[model samples]
Target: MSMNTLPRIEGPHADGADPAGWCDATRAYLPQSTWTGLFPGGSATSAAKALLDMQMLLPGEEGRFTRRFSRAVPGRPRLYGINVDRVMVYKAG
Candidate 1:
């Protein structure tokens, strides 16, 4: 979906808040495929860019990751410093 059609993000605070929390809050509004597409390159920079471009993340949010955020691969599940499967993974600190 285009940025114009995406959900309206309120407040910079919410946009730059916890990634997982934002994902959970937006789950009802966004499709899982949207999140999946955000990390096409499995790099934290790219993923953050996608989110920034989409207005899901604000500028400088990309630097929050201690490691690159990886996408899910065969026989491997995504990690976001939490116990969840098929989610993005990165060390946000």
Candidate 2:
């Protein structure tokens, strides 16, 4: 993607206070994880990296936010309800 086409947006925790907005891009991204299921797992460092890379916004139910993007894994999408994990969401927008 071009420099202007990059989706440089992120959403902070609902209870978070500091404006975790991206202050830099070129050196910001998602954290690295190691492979446990399908792919290797990675660290939750992206949230921090994104803090300085992408513009931080408040978390929302839907829409393009950091949760929608960062929470995305190899196959799984979101985990709703109790501790039950989920692969795809059926909620309507």
Candidate 3:
């Protein structure tokens, strides 16, 4: 619940990619435990930040939206974009 720490994202996380391609890609990786926490409601700033983080949208001329999440290191906080539900929505262009 901070002013501008990190924004929760919105939208679909995956699109125009091989959906099942990532399945066997991690075949040789070790498995670890992960926990999830969901904050359904948040502040305006928080929501804005979340929208930015999720959208990862760049400032444009007008009201054009463009961006997409990444597959590589999707959870890295340094990168900003929308978290399309459970998936990351990175900027496309």
lDDT of each: 0.34, 0.27, 0.28
Candidate 1 lDDT by residue in tens digits, 1-93: 433443333423332333322122322122234445545556655765555454445333245422222222122223222121212232341
Residue 87 CA displacement from its true place in model 2, Å: 31
lDDT of 2 at 51: 28
TM-score of each: 0.23, 0.16, 0.17
lDDT of 2 by residue, 1-93 (tens): 132432333433334322212212332222112112212345233443342233332332454223432442232232111110111121221
Candidate 1 Cα outliers beyond 4 Å, as residue runs: 10-35, 47-57, 60-93
Q: Comparing 1 and 2 by lDDT, which wins?
A: 1
Among all windows of 10 consecutive residues in model 1, the one with the lowest summed lDDT is: 67-76
Q: Tens digit of lDDT per residue, candidate 3, span 1-93? A: 121322223323354422211212111111111001122334433543455555432322233222233445344222222233323223232
In candidate 2, position 8 carries an lDDT of: 37
Q: What is the lDDT of candidate 1?
A: 0.34
Candidate 3: regions farther than 4 A off: 1-42, 56-93
Error of 3 at 72 (Å): 40
Candidate 1: residue pairs that collide: 79-89
State the lDDT at 70 in candidate 1.
26
Model 2 global lDDT (CA atoms, 0 to 1): 0.27
Ranking of all candidate structures by their TM-score, best first: 1, 3, 2
